[model samples]
Target: MYVGIDHSTTGIKVAAIGDDGELTTAFRIDRRNVETAGAFLEVLDDRIGLSRVSLATVTYAFGNAIDEIEGIEDVPNRGTTDLVGLDYGTGAGATVFDRLYDSAVPTVVLPGVHRGLDTLHAFFRHYSALAGADKVASMRYALERFRAEFDASGAFIWVCASSSCMAGLVCGGRLTGFFHWVGPVHGWPDPEAVRRGVESDFEDVFMRCGLLPRRGADLTDVHDIADRDLLQSVYWSTLMNVYALYPFARDLGADGLDAVVLSGRLMRRERPFPLGRRVYEACVDLAPVRFAEPYTSAQGAALVARDVAAGADEVLGIPVGDVPGGRDR
Candidate 1:
C-alpha cells in the first residue's frame, strides 16, 4: 500500500492507495486534536495499519526549504526555511513529520511551488512563495483526472477556494505560475492587514484574514451559514480570482487552457447554492471546467509515492530524489 499525508491549514489528511492505483481509505485529523506524535501515529496505525505501508509521501507547510522531492529523513526543518511568517497549526503537522522521519516507512517529502522552483515562470519570482505542497499535489491530481476524462492535455488552471482562495497555472502538465491574492478571502493578508500586522503583530492578522472569520461567519460548517450576503461574497470572490488568472493562462502561449479545475471545501458545498457548478458555468466560456475530489491532495500524494516507488525520477516536472527503498524499475 502507498500512503500520502497532506498537512493542510485545517487538518492533516491521510490517504492510502493500493498498488493497482485504487484508493483504499482516507481520513482527516484536525490540527487541534493532535496531542503528540506517538498518539497520532497510534491513530494512523489503527486507521491504515502502518506496518503494511510500502512507501509514504508527505507534504508540509511552505515547502520552501527544498526545491525537489526528497526523502523525509533528508529534509531539514520539516521542509521549511522558517515558520516566522507562517501559520503553524498547533504543531500537529510538525509532530507528524517528526514521527515519520524516525519511522522506517521510507517516506518522500514533496516541495511547494516557490521562487526557487525552476519550472515556474520568471515573472512569479516577485513573491518568495506561491502555494503549499498540498496545492501542487492537488494540481497533479487534477492533471491526471483531466487526462483520464478528457483524453487530452495541454494547459489548465486549478482554483482552490475553501478556508482561503488560491489559483495556479499548469501548462503541458507542469506548474508554470500562480496568482497570489492578498485579501480577506485569501490565506495571505491584504496591504491594509499587513499594515495592521506591522502595527501590532502578524500572527493575529494572519489567523483572521480568511473569509469566514473576517466576515464573522462560523468556520465549523460553511454550508450551514445563515448569511446570504456572506455566501454571495464568497461565490463572487472565488469567481473573480479565477477570472483574474484567465488572461494569464491564455497569454502564457499554451493557446488557452484545456480546462479549469476547481477544488477545495467550498467547491464541495451545495446548500444555498451549488458553488462548484456555479463557478463552472461562469467559467465555461473560458474553457471546460471540472471538480476534483475532496481528497485530491492526499490521493495525489499517494500517486506520487506509487510512481516514485516505481522509479519515477520526476513528477509534474518536479525532480525526485533518491528514494530510501524505492525500486529502479
Candidate 2:
C-alpha cells in the first residue's frame, strides 16, 4: 500500500491505495492543524494500518526557498508564505510538512515549479504552486474516473478554486507549466468584487447599472445576470484571461497547443458569464477546446501517488518524481 497526500487550500488530505488500485478512507486535516508525529501515527495506525504502507507522497509549501523538498523546514504555520507575502497572514498550511515528516515514514515531497530552481518547466511550476500539491492529486483522481469521456491527452487545463483561478498543461506524460493568476495577497478579484458589490452601500449606482447578486438563493434565474455583480464577471473574466493567457502560453511553448480545458467553482456557477466561453471562443479561433472535470486536482494527486508507489513514469501525462529517495540528489 502507498499513501498520496494532498496539501490543499482548505485541508491536508491523505489517501491509502492498495496494490489492486483501491482507495480507502482518505483522511484530511485543516491547514491550521498541528499534531505530534506519534499522535498522527496512532490515528493512521487505527484507521488504515500505516505499518503496511510502503511509500508516502505529499505536496505542500515548504518555503519559497525550498528548491528541493529536502531543505524544507517545519515552520510553525501552514503554507502562509505566499499569503503573508500578499499580507494575508494566517499561516494556514505551514505545519503540515513537519507533522507529516515526523511520522518517520518513507516519504517523497513534490517540488513546486519555480524559476528559482532554474527548472526547465517553470511555467507549469507556478500554476501548480498556486493549486499546491493537492490539486494535482485531485486532477489525477478525476482523470482516472473521467478519462473515457474526455480527451485529456496533450491538453492544458484552467481551474478556478476558492481564492484563485489557475491554469496548467499536461504533455510529454508530465505536468507542464501551471500559472497562478491571483497574487499572494489579493487572490482572484472577480468573486470578491461581486460579493462586495452585493452588500455595498453603493447599491443605488449598482442598481442603475442593473447589477445585483443572485436573488433569494436561486442563482440560476435571469435576475442573477440582470444584476450588475454577475454581469461584471464577464468583464472581469475577460480582463483576467487576457492577462493570464500570455504567461500561460509562454509555459506551453512557442509552437502553441493542441487543446484547452476549463474547470473551477466559479466556472460551475449557475450563471455562466462567458469566462470559459470567452476563453474558448478566443482560443478556439487559435486552436481546439476542451472542458475539464471539477475537483480534478484532489483526485489527480491521489492517483499520482498510487502510480508513484508502483514506479510508473507518468500519470495522465504529468511526469512524477520517482521513489522517495530518487530525487534526493
Candidate 3:
C-alpha cells in the first residue's frame, strides 16, 4: 500500500492507496484540535493502517526545500520555504512528519514547485516564485482529466484561488512556468501599476496585498456589509489574480489552452463552487474548464509513493533526488 499526506493550510489530509493503485481510504483531520503527532496518527490509524503503508509521501506547508521527491529526514526545516507566515500548524507538521519518519514505512517528502526550483521555462515566469508541488499535483490530475474527458492533446492552464490565487502552465507534460505574484496577497494590481509593469518582493506583496485574508475571516461582517461594494471589489481582485496568468498559458495569437483546471478552495474533486463557477463561465469561452480539486496533491503524493515503491524515477515529470539543485523560491 502507498500513503499520501497533505499538510494544507486548513487541515491534515491523508489517503491510502491500495496495491491496485486505487485510493482506498481518505479523510481530512481538522487542524483546530490536532495538537500532537500522536493525535494526528491516531486519527489516521483509524482510517488507514500506518502499518500497511509501505511507502508514504508527505507535503507540509510551503514545501520549498528539496525540489524533487526525497525522504523526510533528508530535508531541513521540514520542507518549508523561509517559514514566513507559515505558522499555521508547524508543531502539528513536525509531529506528523516525525512520527512518519520513525514509522517502518519508507516515507518521502515533496517540494512545492517554485521559480528557483527545477521545471520547464517559458516566456513568462513568476516574478521570483511560483507555487508548491500541490499546484503541480493538480496539474498532473488536470492532464489526466483532459486526456480522459477531453480526448484532446494540448497544453492547459490551472487557475487556483482561495486564500490566494496562483497559476501554473503545463505543456507537453512539463510544468513550464507559474504565476504567484498576483496571488491573494497580491490583491488587485492597480491599472497604473500594470501600465508601469510594477514589481515588488513577493513576500512584501503577500503580506500587504490580495483582496481577502488567506485564512480566517469574519464572514459575519462580510455578510452584513451594505451596498455590496466590498464584496464586488474583492471579487474583481480575485478575477484579476486569475486572469493575470491567462496570457502566460499560451503563446501570442495562440488558440488558448486546451482546458482550465479550477483549483484550490474554489474547486474540488471535479466540483466547482461559486467563485470557481464564475471562473469556468469566464474562461469556458476560451476552452473547456474542469474543476480539479487541489487535494489531488495528496493523491499525487500517493502516486509518488506508489511509483517510488515500484522503483520509478519520477512522478509526472518531477525529478526524484535526495537533494534539490537550487535554492527554494
RMSD of each: 2.5, 8.7, 6.4
Higher-ranked by TM-score: 1 or 2: 1
**Candidate ranking (lDDT, best to worst):** 1, 3, 2
Writing each residue's lDDT as its tens digit, candidate 2 over 1-329 gives 76766544445556776766566567665544433232455556677676776766666642343333331233223432353223213233335455566766666555444443333364444422344555455445544554454443343444443334455545433455555544211233355455665676332222122122223333233312334354344436433543455455445553454445555544444444544555556666544565655435544554555566566654544344434623322
TM-score of each: 0.90, 0.58, 0.76
lDDT of 1 by residue, 22-100 (tens): 8899899877777443467787889988799999989988798999889898898888887655657348888888888
- Tell me the whole-model lDDT of each prediction, alpha carbons only: 0.78, 0.47, 0.61
lDDT string, candidate 3, 1-329, tens digits: 77788765556777777767676877778765565435876777667766776878887766776667787768877777575433343466667787776766678887777655655564443443456556665566566546654423356777776545677766656676666654433343455434433453333333344444433343223212232333344345546645665675555323567777777654331222245556667778767787765466677677667766766666656787642221231
What's the TM for model 1?
Answer: 0.90
- The lDDT leader among the candidates is 1
Question: How many angstroms is residue 183 displaced in model 2 relative to the true structure, after the best TM-score fit?
Answer: 7.8
Pitting candidate 1 against candidate 2, the one with the higher lDDT is 1
